[model samples]
Every structure is written in C-alpha cells, then in structure tokens.
Target: MTTTPSLSRTDWTLILSLALLTFVLGTSEFVIVGILPDIADGLSISIATAGTLVSAFAITFAIGTPLTMSFTSHLPKRKLMLTLTAAFIVFNLFSSLAPTYGILLVLRMMTAVVTGVLISLAMLVASESVPTGKRGIAVSFIFGGFTMANVFGVPLGTFIGQRTGWETTFLLTTTLGVIAFFAVYRVVPSQLTSVKTSIADQLRLLTNPRILIAFFIPAFGFGATYVVYTYLVPILKGVLGVPVAWISPILFAYGFISIFSNMAAGKIASHNPIGRLRFVFLIQALVLAALYVTTSNVTLGLINIALMSFMAILLTTSTQIYLIDLAEKFNPDAKGLASSLMPVASNVGIGMGSALGGLVYANAPVMTLALVAGAVALVTALLTAVSHQLDQR
Candidate 1:
C-alpha cells in the first residue's frame, strides 16, 4: 500500500474516540489488581480469592470474546460498538454495587465478556476508517489507549480506590465509559456496514495454516513479556533491592515508557509487519536476556526493565494488522473474528506465561525467569520468521 502523508481530521477524531473507549476498557480490566486487598477486606474474602477476579476476567475474555464476536458478526458496526460500550458501562455500574465477593466476581467476568469485543471493535473501526497505510497508526492509537490506561487511568484509579473505596474505582470506570460512549456515538459513523457471516464462517479461520500460525505470534510475543511482568514487583524488591517507597514511581515510569513503545509499533505495522516483527522479537529477546545480568545492579536493572517495557507491546499493533489483513485475503467475512484474535491470543499468552513463570519462580532463582521469558521471546522471533516465509509461498 502507498503511504498517505497524514491522516485527515475526521479520521483522527474517529480514531481518538475509539482510543478513549479502549482507555476506559483497559482501566476497568486492570485496576482491580491495585485494589485487590481493599476488595478482599470490603467483602470479607481472602486476598487470594480477591485475586481470582483478575484471572477470571482474563480467562473469560480469552474464551468468550470470539464466540460473542462471531455470533454478533452480522450486526451493523456502529450499533454493535455502541451496544458493547453501553453493556460495558452497565456491567461496571453493577460491579460498583455488588454486595458480595461472588457477585463482584461474576460481574467482573460479565464485564470481561464485552471488554475484549469492544476493544476489537475499536481496532476494526479504526482500521477500516483510515487509509490503508494509515491503518497501522489508527490501530496503534487504539492500542495506545490501553498503555495510556496503564500510565494514567490505572494509577489514578488505584489512588481513588485507596483513598475512597474500592467500589469508587468501578464508579470511576463507569463515568469514563459514559464519556467514551458519547465520544464514540458522536464520531463513529452510524451507517458503518459489517461483512455478514455465519458462526461457521468465522470459525473456519482456524483452518487456515497461515492464520493459525499468525495467532501464536501474539501469544508468544506477549507471553515473553508477561512471564517476567507477572512477577515484576517481587523481582524489583528481591532481585534489584528496590525499597517499597520507590515501587510506585518506578512502575509509573515503566507505564510512561510503554506509551512510546505503542507509538513505535504503529510505524512498524505500517509496512512489512511480519518482517519487522521478526526483528522486534529478536531485540526483545536480547533485552530479556540482558535482564539476567542487569538484575544484580539497581541502576542497570531499572534501565533494563525500562528497555523491556519499551519492547513489550512492540508486536501488538503489527500482529493485529497482520491478523486482520490475512482475514481480508482468505476470508473477508470473518474479519470480525480476526479482530478478536489479537486480544484473545494476548490473554492466552499472559495466562500461559504467568503460570509458567509461577512454576519457575517457585522452583528456581527469580532472575532465571527472565532467561525463560527470553527463550519464549526467541520463539516469537522464530514464529515471525516462519510467518514471513509463509507469506512468500
């Protein structure tokens, strides 16, 4: 595709609106982690049980998203987006009022059912609304919202939860969702058409070897980061000898760096995505490996981690564009399902990597987890190379 000079104002509006919606969605999904203890205390549940909200949301998001998206593929694009956004707000509203831990857990899971689909819809809308060359930037900005949530929304929500109450965190999310809904409605075209397809049509995407391999790219790429990220606090405190007082600032800085990483991913996806992804993962693998040596020194450890954070989402935008582009080639009608794959694969990677990391952490030195994650990142590079080769054939 020929490169466009710049996105038009209208395109920017639509994309930004979608980004705002994703920021809200991202905040809702992740803010629970910071307030897990508060939630446990509020509901008289163990902290371990409160932690299940995070895992449950991720599992449901991975399993439920494609099914929900596939079944709703025929709906008008704008309506589907609005409906999902409204549903998200309603779920969060209820979540804010749940009287019991079980009720809150169920609401969080229900919220997950719509969360991934809404994010996928945002990416789909952004990609289709822009020129081909600019689609990458559009999608990246949509993903950028999540990073922004990490940078701004999650931290702010955490503060609110701590100072006020945990329930207030969901209420904050609901307020943001309401704003996002209006932004989406005002900017998104009401007549946006969708490619009509049956559930079988969407499921048939799994039969394509190219796509099957493509799905694993995000899984491995993201898994590489999550393995270590899942235990980041412990690594910082135990391995790097970082004091408790500095942890928040360090995490805030990490999230701040991730926003730039998200922007870099846009440019990578703008052309030759698979080829670029091959090297992105390779560099990421090298960075993760470096963490083994760096963890022994506080300054080096922080810098290496910042570098790792920069590499974290480098694959996300490109992988997303890759999946949607492949679907367009082999099965145009299944593009909605394709849109859902990046998030689904990402959650799968996170779950798998965290589980693997937990096992390793229990049995080996914490620094060893970085080497294991690096190996997974190398696998991501290998998969990308294979994907690029398949493209040639």
Candidate 2:
C-alpha cells in the first residue's frame, strides 16, 4: 500500500509561496482587462488597438512556454523560479513606465513569456512536493491564488486605475512581484527538480496527435469565454447600462464565484477529468448561449456574467491533470513539456477568443460575443467527447 508523503511546515510554506506567486502573476496578466480603457486613453490609441495587448500577451505566452520549459528542463527548480520572478519584477516595472503604446505592447509580451513559464513550473513544484493523493489539492491551492486575483486583484486594480491611472495598477503588480520574489527565494527548496529529457523527445511528445487534440480543447473552451470577456467593460457599460462605479463590484462577484468553481473543479477533476470537462463545457456553452437572451436586462446580464465566469474556468485543473497524465503515459521524460503546454493551450485560446471578439465587436452588435462564444464552447464539448473516447480506447 502506498503512503501519503508527510509534509512539514516548510512544505506547506513552499506551497503557499508558490500560490502567492501565481496570484501576483495572474493579477499581472488579468488586471489589464479592467484598465484597457484607461490604457487606450493614456496612449492615445483606439480601444481596439488597446485590446491587441491582450492578444499579444496571450500569443507570446502560448508560443514561449513550451520552448522555455524545454530549454530549462534541467535547471534547478528554485533557481529557475527565482530568475523568472526577478525578470517578472523588472519587466512589470518597465511596463508601468512605458512611454508609448508600442513600448507597452512589447513590454507586455515579454512579461507574458515569463508568466507562462512561472505558472507551469509552480504546478510542477507543487505536484512533486506533495503526495499523489494531495496533488490535486496542491494544484487547486495554486489556482486559488489566480482566482483570488480575479476576485480581489482585478477589481481593485481596476478601481485604482480608474482613480489614479493605469500605471498605478502596473506598479501594484510590480510590488506583488517583489513579494513573490522574496517568498520564492526563501521558501522554495533549491533541490527540487524534474526528469531531464532531450529536446528531440520533448518535441516528439508535443507532436502526438492525442496530446495535440487535448491542447486544442482548452484553446476553444477558453476562447469561447474570452470572446465576451475581452470586452466585458464595454458590455457592462453599453448593454447592461451599468454605471462605471458599479462595474468593479460586479466583476468582484464574478471573480469570487470563480474561486469556488476553481476549487470544485480541482477536487472533481482528479476523480474523472474527462467526464468533468465534458459536463463543464456543456454548461459553459449553455450559459454563454443564455447570455444572448439575458444580457438586455441589467440584473439578468449580471447573473449571466457571473454564471459564465463560474463555468468558464471549471476545466482548468482537469485539463492540467489530463495533459500531465497523458504525457507521462506516453513519455514520462517529457512530462515537463506536457505540463508546460496546458498554459500554452490556454493562452492560445485567450488569443484566439480575444482576437475574434475584437472582430465581432468591430462588425456586429457587442451582444453577439455571447453567440460566437457559445458556438465555440459547443465545439469544445465535442472535442471533450472525442478525447474521452480516445482515453477509453
């Protein structure tokens, strides 16, 4: 019989530190959505142009993560995380000081590359530190930091940005990064490491058809949400007729609900990842579709927004577990690559969804984001079914 690893105070501290780092990183990534209008005005750019910052960050993160993980696979986890955190701090500070829209865009892409690496590595660290039975909880704890960012960080950042300026929001992220750097440096053990694999092996694992399909599931599922989320501020202001002051509160509620959803997904995912994902995708698709009908009423629109937020991230932990397990099954040596790809797939979805949302916003009524997103969620559900069948076989 297997025994659970006995964790000491240090282990718990390490886990919590990683979670805190993710909170900081997630806030850096997501806070921009709340302050995009401010960014546009500050830089004298169109809101559409400002929206490209999201796409730029997502695309860079998607492309950079696997490559970075492959190259750094042999490095000591503690050193690698510290280096990434240091870079994150420097770049976020620069982002706050960016003099032009173009400069800010470039800075965001650089920050995103580091953000991607940090998230994947944190998961790897958590999984390695904990017993198999507790890995799901560990992952959930890390993700809890992310959900908390949405719950408290994003809304608070938005409020600060609205009052003081968007630069202040980035500065706050920089402060958080500084805290993360210290926590990681002090708490994360330097000896933590993963199985080393050759570049060729990592590349081969990434090319597997099953793994590729798994990757695309998140791309579409998350893309479905980003379709509407990229323009959430505008939607609240225009469609729901919500006052600017009320937007942050509503987002806070949406984000708070997401925390519970994320935790629940983590717990359920360990038991039946494919089944949980299938159910989540179906509900998400339905919620998004309901948005088309409900968004005209302020109360209903807020409720729909909350529902969508709750449903949108339910697959995250499951997808992460599924990809890691699949990679280990196919090539244990390439597990790092597999683990790294989860966020890559997610960012790809974000980029696609946000870019598509931009197009829809330009050409159609803003409410149409829900329809487009709903269709994409349906596609995600189909992908989940296919993945489950493949797993069963």
Candidate 3:
C-alpha cells in the first residue's frame, strides 16, 4: 500500500481548479432545467418535448462517459482535462448559435459526451492529488461546485435566459468554461499519473456484482430527485402558484440549501457511508412523498422542495468515495473508470427519471411526479439496504 503525502498549497490550487471546472460543467448540464420554458418557447416546442433535452443529454452522458473514460484512461490527466474543457467551451458556444431545435439538441448531445467524463476526471485528479485522509472532503469540494452551480450559475443563467434569450444561457456557460480552462491549465500538474489499464481491464470492473450494485445505488438514489427536479419549474409555477418573477430566487434558495447537503455528505462518507446511506434514502423517500401532500400549500411546498433539494445530493460523496475504494480493492488499476461510475449512474438516473416524468406529464397531472419519484426513492432505499448487507458480508 502507498501512503498519500500531505497536501501543499499547490495541491489545494489543483483541487480548487478542478472544482471550478466541475462547476462550469454542472452549470451547463443543469441550467437547462431552470431555463426549460424559455427554450421551449424559443423553439416553438411543447415544454414536454423540450424536457426531453435533459433526458437526452443525461442518457448520452450515462452511456458515453465510461466508454470515453476507458479510451482516455492512458492519457496524462492534465492534458486530457484541458482538452476536454476546451471541447466543452466550443460545444456550448455552438449550442448558443444553433439554428433550430434539432441543431441545439445535437449540440447538447455532443456536449454530453464530454461532461460526465470531465467530472469524473475532476474527481480522479482531486482524489489522487490530495492526501488519503482528506480524499472525502476533497472530492466533496469538487461536488460542491455542482451545488454552487445550483446556487449561482443556474439561477443566474435562468435569469439571463428569462430576460434576454435562452441562447444567452449557453454563452454564459461558455464564458465560465473559458475561465475554468485557464485555471486548470495553470494549476493542475502537467505530470500527474495516468492509468495504464487497457479498455478490456477497465470494462471488467462492470463484471463484478458488487461494483454493479454500487453503481446503481447512485443511479436510483439520485434518479428519484431528477424525476421531480426535471419539472420543478412548472411545478413552481403551475402547482405552487409562484409568480414567474420569483422562479430564480426560489431556485437560489434550493441551491443554497444544497450546499449544506454536499457538506454533510462529505462528513457522512468519512464514516460508515454505506450503512448511513440507507437511512438517508429512507428520509429522501419520505421527503419526496411529502411533496405530494405539501404541493397544495405554497410555503409548505417550497419548504418541501428545499428538503428534496437537500436530500437529492446527500448520497453523492458517500457513493463516490465508496466506488473508488471498492474499485481499488477489486480492480486497482481502474480508478478512472471507478470515478466515472457515480456520475454515470447519477446521470442514468436523471435520464431514466426525467424520461419517466415526461411520460407521466404527458398522461397525468404534473403534480403526480412527486408520487412517482417517491416510489423510486423507496426502491433506492431498498437497494441501499441490500448494498449495506453485502458490505457486511
């Protein structure tokens, strides 16, 4: 076994740069939800059809990321990180200039190809670059970028899109990406270690049942949130009767609460993460179920949404650290691949939940999304229990 060195100031810079990049990526990925109505209106598509953009991007991210990680596993981390961030910027630029819905959707799919992998790389870099004892907090800080994206990026993008045009939101994301690219280039070490594992070896991690189940825990656990989250805009307006002007501020509040969620997740991961996560999922289910009862009252509904937002990310850090540790035990050479699993699974859940929510929206009332998502959360709890039992054995 190797010992991790204490973190230097340079190491902190490296971790924070990676965190900034993830923030930009997370912003671009999630800002669409905040601006969905604007995009729908701009393209003359039904909001339901527009919602498919989130599902499409997530599904592509879910399916494309691990393959990308496998292929790129041998490359130097710094160069790969820089190259991916550049591609992300270009894609977002083109997405802003896209002529029609088809073109925009295609741009989003192209962007998705790199988004998940970029996030995985960020985690891989932060985990490797920091001391072993601090890996949980370090990785959580990387995820904190996503929560901050919720706090600042998404709300700001939504406000911009609402005021100017939906295309402008992509431009905002592009600018952030540029800043992240330079930060990464300046701070991330040019010579960080890269995995030499073959694609076949990396893919072998999937063959292990423990690895597979571990991956799905994030998928189902986080998927429950996307089910309702994908439609939160409409729910806020149509169900809760929130004014159009209040949307961004409400989203700001949700993201603000989520920052604490990410912090708590890091701490939880430092202990018995798998055992603790089962109860976390149980609480998530109850909160999601509460959305059904609370939707009729605006104050109660917003509070419930805040609770849902908080629970949405509680599993992330725990599952992330868990996956990397499990991979080290089972497939030591495939840390990059292991790093991809949680993000991939979370996006899978996002795609599955968003697609499911779209179907429900088409046939049922939008408010029904709460109940459907609650059921998914319940299953997530069961899966967590099973995983915890397996951990014991």
Candidate 4:
C-alpha cells in the first residue's frame, strides 16, 4: 500500500522485467493478426482455419485465468510468477518449433494457459506495489507493456516475418521469454501471503453484480474496439485500397496513438473513472463513425484509424481500477478474482468483437463493420452510466 515498495530500486527492476514479459505475451497474442496469412500458408491451411489460432487463445484465456487464480491461490506470488514465466519460455519454444498447424494450436493453447497466470499476477503486483492513490498509475505502467507490445512488438514481429520469416518472430519472442524468466526471478518480490480458500468461495465472490458489470464495461467497451482492429489490415487493404507496404505503417501510427491514449486514460481515470469511461466510449463511437465515411480514401482512412485506436482502449485502465476498488470496498476477499477477471473479460471482448465482425463480413462491406463497432461503444457508454447510477444508490 505504499509507493515506497513499488518505487524502490528492486521494484523498478521487477517492473521492467514484468513489463517486458507482458510485451512478449502481448506480441504473441496480436502478431497472429498480422501474420495470419503467412501462418496459413506455412500450415497449408485456409485463412479461416488459421484464424482459429486467435480464437483458441481467447477461449483458453477466458477459461484459464480464473482457474489459474483459484488453483494457485495457495502458492506464493513469487513462485507462481516464476512458474508461469518458465511455462511461457517452454510454450513459446514449442510454438517456434511447431511444424504443423495442429502442433501450433497446441503450443498456442499452452501459451494461453500460462498467459492467464502471468497477466493476472502482473496486474496484482503492479497494483499492490503502490499506494492506493497511486494504484491507477502503477496499473497503467504495467499495462503500458501490453499497449507497447502492440506498438513495438507486433510491428517488429511483422518486420521479422517480412524479412526472414514469420517463424523468425516466434524465435525472437521465445528468446525474449527466456530473458523475462530471469528478470522475474531476480526482481519481483513476494506478495503478502493470502489465506487460501476453496473455489466455491471464489465463485461466490465473482457473482456480485457490480463486479460482473464492472467486468462488462471492459469486456464490451474494448470489445467494440477489437471489432474493427482485428481486421484492420484487411480493411486497409481491401476497402481503402492501401498497399501491403502501407498497412504496417498505419498500424504503427495507430500503436503510437494508443500509447499516449493509455497514459491519458490513467490521468482521466484518476479524476473520475466512470465519467471518463463514458467520455471515452463516446469518442470511440464518433471516431469509428468517421472511419466508416473515410474508408474510400487511404490517407483519410489512416487518420481516423489512428484516432479510433487512440480512444479505443481509453477505458481499460479505468475499468480495471474501478473493479479493484469495488472489490476492496465490498467483498475485500475478491480482489484477486476481480484483478484476474479483467483480462478474462478482455479476451472475451476480443472474441465477441471478432465474431461480430465476421458476421457483418457476409452482410455488407468492410466499412459497415466500423459502424457496428461504433454501436457497440454507444451501448457500452449506456451500461457505464447505468452501472454508475446503481452504485451511487
């Protein structure tokens, strides 16, 4: 509960390492989108079948995070993190060496399993390392790794694939995972031990409406963002008529904006999370709408894509902070569940957003997908307001 712990020299070392690991995990999760075609080609699979790799990771993450938290409840946070990092190293290596699509699927699923534990603990460590007033900022710093992965990792992964091969990026990330293991082992300190509880108690704590809704704000808010993002490369090339060479640069720009917006969300969240969340959704809605109209022009389309990407994750930090705060206030025992569920909800959002986009794919043009995404934002804003009103009373 003191910044003293998080700011201490050792904590910074741990934070950097944890952030780097997250960057690696985040890259693995997203690099699929960029290299989907390449993976498909290498495995002699269809694009849709290759896309299942992304779906599989989400499914595993959704089921995996809480199960991991409940099962590891008795383990020391340090031990659990180290174990997860080791698993990350192994699975990433498995993915790198995977020869067939079947093997790749299994390796990715394994990666998802460890990802659940690693991500959940990373958030908890970051939050607990700081004072309550500074929790938002600390959580922001940790998640900043995730955002940066999208910015730096995905692009770099794409570069490796373009230059050498898609497999090369996996090799690069696997090496990063090995380094992260050492970092976690050396730097991250043990958390105050928790009284172990059965899964039933964890379930009871998870059933609270506020927790469920708080989770939904994130699940759907960013879900809406992914509806467009998941297929951004296709939208850029197919609809906007941009060349392949141009798509990556636009994505890089979008990533740059996301980094700044993520920090902005932290500041705005510290003021009033609920209100800022509503404002963020509203901005996202407008930006998505603007993108739909500009899809015919490569330059204009690029600008709006960056704008929407900047605002898309604006509520992620606020939503996490809100849930953690809610859990501490009411069911103090559920903080771990609440922290772990944030990423689970995020994975769910990604699945839902992608499914929604896939549905619209048959109905209309790519630009219509942007409008569908905008609608999701509007609905999320309403839910945010409704949940706030309920909490106030």
Candidate 5:
C-alpha cells in the first residue's frame, strides 16, 4: 500500500495553484454562451447547432472522468495531475488555434475530458492533505476558483471574445493553462499515493447507493442550470431583444453575482449542509421558473440573470463538501473514486441539461428553455430532499 500524502506548504500552494487552473478551464468551457452567435456565424452553422459545442463538452465530462481516473488511479497522483494539466493546457491551445469548426469541436471535447480528470484529482488532493473539519472548506475553496471564474474569467473572456473574436478567449485560456502548469509544478510536490485496484474494482464504488444518491443531485441540479445557460445567448438575443454588444456585459454581470453566491454558499454550508443546500436548490428552481415570464422584459431578464447566476453554483460547492464528508466516513479507501464522482454527477447534469435544452428548442420557442430548466431543477430539489432524509438517517 502507498502511504497517504501529508500536508506540506507545498500542498497548500499547489492546492491554490490547481484551483486557478480550474478557474480558467471552467471559464473557457462555458464562456462561449455570451458569444455563441459569433462562433455560429464564424463556423457557418446555425445557432442551435453551435450549441452542441457546449453539450459535447459536457458529454465528454460525463463519460470520461471515471475512465481517466481508473486508468491513472494507481500512478502517483501528483505526476498524474501535472501530466493531465499539461495535456489540458495543450488541448486549450488547440482550441485557440483550431482552424476549422470540426477541429475546434474535437479539441473542446478533449479539453473537457481532461478537465473532468483535473477536477477529480484536485478534490482527491484536497481530501488527502486537509483535516476533516476543514476539508469541506478546502474543497470548497478549490471549487470557489471555478465559481470565481464566472465572476472574473468567463465574463472577462466573454467581453474579450465579443470585442475581438471568440478565438481570443482561447488564447486567454491557453495563457491561464500555461501559468497553471508552472504553478502546479512548483507549488504541488510530487507525492505519489497507492491504489492497487483494477478498473473493475474502481467501478464498484459507483455501486454503493449512498454514492449514487450523493452523485444524483448535481447531475439533475446542474443539468437544469445548463439548460438555461447553454442557450443563454439565444435567449438574450432572440427573446429579450438584447443587442449583440450588450450580451457580454450581461454575462459579466451574471458572473459577478455568481462570485458572491459561491462565497455565501461555502460560508453557509459550513453550518447547515442539508438545509443550506436544499434551500439553494429550491431557490434555484424558483429563479429559473421565473425566467419564463421575466425573460420577456429585458430589464427583468438581465436582473434575474444575475440572481440565477448567484443561485446556479450553490448546489455544486455544497455537494462537493457533502461528498468529502461521506467519503471520509464510509469509503476512505475509495477517495479518488469519491472525489471524481462529483464531476461525474455534475457532468451527467450538464449532459442532461444540454440535451433537454436542445430537445426543447427543437420544437418550441426559446422561452420554453427556461421552463425546461426550471422543471429539471424542481425534480433535482425533490430528489435531493428525499436523499437528504436518507442521509440524515
């Protein structure tokens, strides 16, 4: 058996460093929404088709994370993380330089898969080093990097992309990835941990009911968020009648509110995991539901966008902490699997959200997307409430 990694200043620095990587990766993953029209036009595709770029990436994350974790689980995690980040960095560079739309789509999928792995690995590292009480905060801190990505990275990238071109956003993403590579190299020491399990053994972790339920909320919750988010550009442009120039700023505003929501989630979850998360999920359902009526009025829509962004990520951070707690209590041996499962849940949500959003748009007008999203969120919250009761018992 490999010894567990002990906390060092090195771990602390790398934790923050990897968190920054997630910020850029996440921002790039979702930033296209604000500028989806430019991308669609540039590629000579319809806006609805251009939307696949979002869904495709989410699909990759849903399917790719566990396989990547299983294949690499036994290797030294530090080395694996660095290598995956480097691969991720290169893939983003490819996204920046992709000449044809086909290449860009492929590269985005590649980046998403590695991103899924990076997300899981970062959580595993956090769990390894931090004490139990502070572990949730630590994990939340790392995820906070992603939340702040909306606050800073995605909005800024959207603005830059809209001003120059969508290609520029990939450049910005590449720069962030390069900076992250070095940061992880310097700050995160190469501490290898052991896992002797075969791939089949790793799969067994998902068989546990608690783990399944633990993973379920985010899939449904974030899927709901993505249904609205994946088509935000279309909704803003088509329904709200926002002009092209204003879209970036609107997204910027949403990202800004998301930061505060992310922090508030971490702070509140520290006290009441079940109540706080459950409340956030319910509020998210309400806020998304309101978008149908509110999105008709530009002022109402943009204001509600801010409110929705704030509510969007609350479930993610809380669910992450909840998983860490559950992992420590029941499945210490499966830390890597548990850590990785969160993304699996969210990615599953992302796929469901994107697919459902796409399905709705195929038949109905854009406003229906909000209703679709709100309905999914309602289901997620209901299931989560039941799960929470089971969790309590």
Candidate 6:
C-alpha cells in the first residue's frame, strides 16, 4: 500500500513561489515573440533576422540545460535556484541595455542558459517539496506559472513593447525576476538536498531506450504546436483577416483558456498519465487538422486556435510527471539529468517546429503549417501509445 503525504500551508507557499519564478522566466522567454517586430525595427534588422533571437534562445536552452545541470548537480537545490535567479536577473538587465542586435542576441543566449537550468532546478524543488502522490500537482502548478505568463505577461509585454520599446519588456522581466528572487529566498526552504550523481552515471541514462523515447515524446508533441504557433500572428492577420489590433486580445483569450486547460491537465495527469497524454495528443492532432480547414473563416479560425492552445499544454504536466517517475524508477541516481531533459527536449521541439515553420512560410501558404504540425501530433500520439504498452508489459 502507498500513502500520499499531506501538504501544509508552507508547502503550498513554496510551490506558489516556484510557480512565480517560472512565470517570470517564461514571460522573459516568450515575450520575444510578441515584440519581434519592435525588436526588428528598433535594431534596424529584418523581422526574419530578429526572429533568430527566438531560435537562439531555444537552441541554447536545448544545449545548455543538461550541461548546466551536470555542472550544478552537486549544489544544494535552494542555493542553486537562487544563484540561477540572480544570473537570470542580471543577464536580462544586460539584455535591456544591449545597444546592438548582436549584443542583445548574446545576452538572450546567456539568459536562456540560466533560465533552462533554473526551470529544471525549480521542478526538482517542487517535486521534492510535495508528497509523492502530489508531485504531479506541484509540477502542474509550476507549469501553470508559465501558462500565466502567456495569459497576462506576454500580452501586457506586447502592449508595452508596442508603445514604449522592446527593451522595456526585458526591463519588466528583470523587475519580476527581482520579485521572484526575494520570494524564493523568503519562502523556499533552504535545507533541500541536491541529487548527487557523477557525470558517467548521468550519461548512462542517455543510453536507455525508454528514457530516450520518453524525452522525444515532448519533443514531437511540442513541435506539433510550435510549428503553427511560431507564425500565429501572420496567420491571424494575413490568412484569417483579423485586424492587427485584435491579435493581442485573441492571444490573451487563448492564454486565458490555456490556464484552465493546464489545471485540468494536472488533474487528469495525476490519475492516468499515459491515457491523459494520448487523449490530449489525439485532440491536438485533430484540432490542428481542423485549424487547417478553418483558417479561411475568422470565427472558425479563432475557435480552432483556442482549441489548439487548450489541448497543446495538456500534455506538459503529464510529461513531466511521467519522465520524473521513470527516472526515479529506472535511473534513480541520475534523476536530475532526466528532469533537466524534459525542458531540453521541449526546446528541441520548439526549435524544430520553428525551423520547419520558417521553411513552410517561405515556400508554402501558412495554413499548410497546420497540416504538417497535425501530422506530427499524430506521430506523438502513436509514440504515447507505444510507451503505454511498454509500461503495461
């Protein structure tokens, strides 16, 4: 028999603080999309060149996460979290002050490296802070912070960037980072021990087929969404005929719906991780297919976008929980590396999707992105089914 640990108020406070930390980092990462045009105009670069900032961040994050985690594996969780938070704040501040696009790009890469490690560490903290049974909920709460970033942070940052400048968005992120740093300092318990594992042990987990497959589940799953999502503004404005002014609000609505979807995912994931992922991925694939069909009409297009956003994030918590659980069961000594790989795989998916979207945008109509992404989502569902069967066996 298994028992769920009871969480106290202090645990909830710590969880909320970690969530806020993710919200701050997520907003800094994602706000670039909303302000891409401003960044291009401000730096006298083409929008396409400015867009590389996004890719730079994602690529760096993908490469940097495990590397950073390996180096910091010996440090206490709270101390490492605080250190990363400080680095994040300082780098984002430098980003806002970057005079040239080149300098800004470098600063963003620095921030991404730290942010990736920070998020991975945050997950470890959250999972350790909660009862074993509630790990899913804690992970979801942290991810919910990112959802909140999309909901309030990105739109508001977009509005501010449009009016003042894109640099202002970075400055704002820095401020939020400061607040998050203090919150973590005050609330998060400092006695949490680190997961100590040698480099060889960590590397050995990579050789495991199950870990490798589990890592790619998110890579393809997120790739499916980001392929269309990278060009969502153009899709809404040029293809769907939505006015420029309404794009933010539409995104705001999409983000708003995502919050509930994220919470619902948390609940469903706790009960049935594999089944929940299958359902979410299947719905995501179908919705992307519907998005391809609906792009010609504004109402249907908006509805499909909302549905896609809703279903897209449903896999996040489950993915985190499943991977971590897998790590604990199969690769206990290297659970840190396993946890870190979740975000790394996610960024890989983001990078792939964005790169593919760019290719489609150059050669084909934007609506075609949906078809390609939908196919990817279907592949993700199949992978989930295979993973489920393997677990059952």
Highest TM-score scorer: 1
The window of 10 residues in a row where model 5 has the poorest summed lDDT is 2-11
For model 3, the stretches where C-alpha displacement exceeds 4 angstroms are 1-8, 33-52, 100-103, 162-167, 233-247, 295-298, 358-371
Against the reference, the lDDT scores of all candidates come to 0.92, 0.87, 0.88, 0.80, 0.78, 0.87
Judging by lDDT, tell me the better candidate of 1 and 4: 1
In terms of lDDT, the best-performing candidate is: 1
Which portions of model 4 miss their true places by more than 4 Å? 1-11, 41-44, 162-167, 294-300
**Number of clashing pairs per prediction, in order:** 0, 0, 0, 0, 1, 0
What tens digits encode model 1's per-residue C-alpha lDDT throughout 1-393? Answer: 754768999999998989999999999999999899999999999999999999999999999998988999889888888888899899999999999988998999999989989988888888887888898899989999999998899989999999999999999999999999999889998766676767898999979998989999999988999889999999999888899999989999999999999999999998898998898999999999899999888999999999999999999899998999999999998998999999999999999999989999999988899999999999989999999998988
What does candidate 2's lDDT look like per residue over 121-208, in tens digits?
A: 9988887777776777778788888888877888788899999999999999999999999999888877776667788878789789
Candidate 3 Cα lDDT to native: 0.88
Instruction: Please report, as a residue range, the 10-residue window in candidate 1 with the lowest summed lDDT.
Output: 189-198
Tens digits of per-residue lDDT, candidate 4, 1-393, equal 533333566556656777787888898788877788888888799999998898899899889788878777767888888888888887877777789999999889888878877888888777777566666666677788899998888888888876787788788888888888888887777755554777777667677887878888888987898888878888877888888888657767888888888788777766678976777788888888778888878778878887887787778778887877887887776577777887898888988888898888778877888889999989898889888888778
Ten contiguous residues with the weakest lDDT in model 2 = 2-11
At residue 329, give the lDDT of candidate 2: 90
TM-score of 2: 0.88
Task: Give the Cα error of residue 144 in candidate 4, in Å.
Answer: 1.4
Question: What does candidate 6's lDDT look like per residue over 109-224, in tens digits?
Answer: 99999999988888888887788778788888899999999888888888898999988998899999999999989987878767677888777888888988888899999899
| TM-score per candidate, chains pooled | 0.98, 0.88, 0.88, 0.91, 0.82, 0.93
Candidate 1, lDDT over the whole model:
0.92
Candidate 5 C-alpha lDDT tens digits along 272-364? 676667777788888998999998788898888888888887776667777756766776556677777777887777777877998998888
Error of 6 at 317 (Å): 0.5
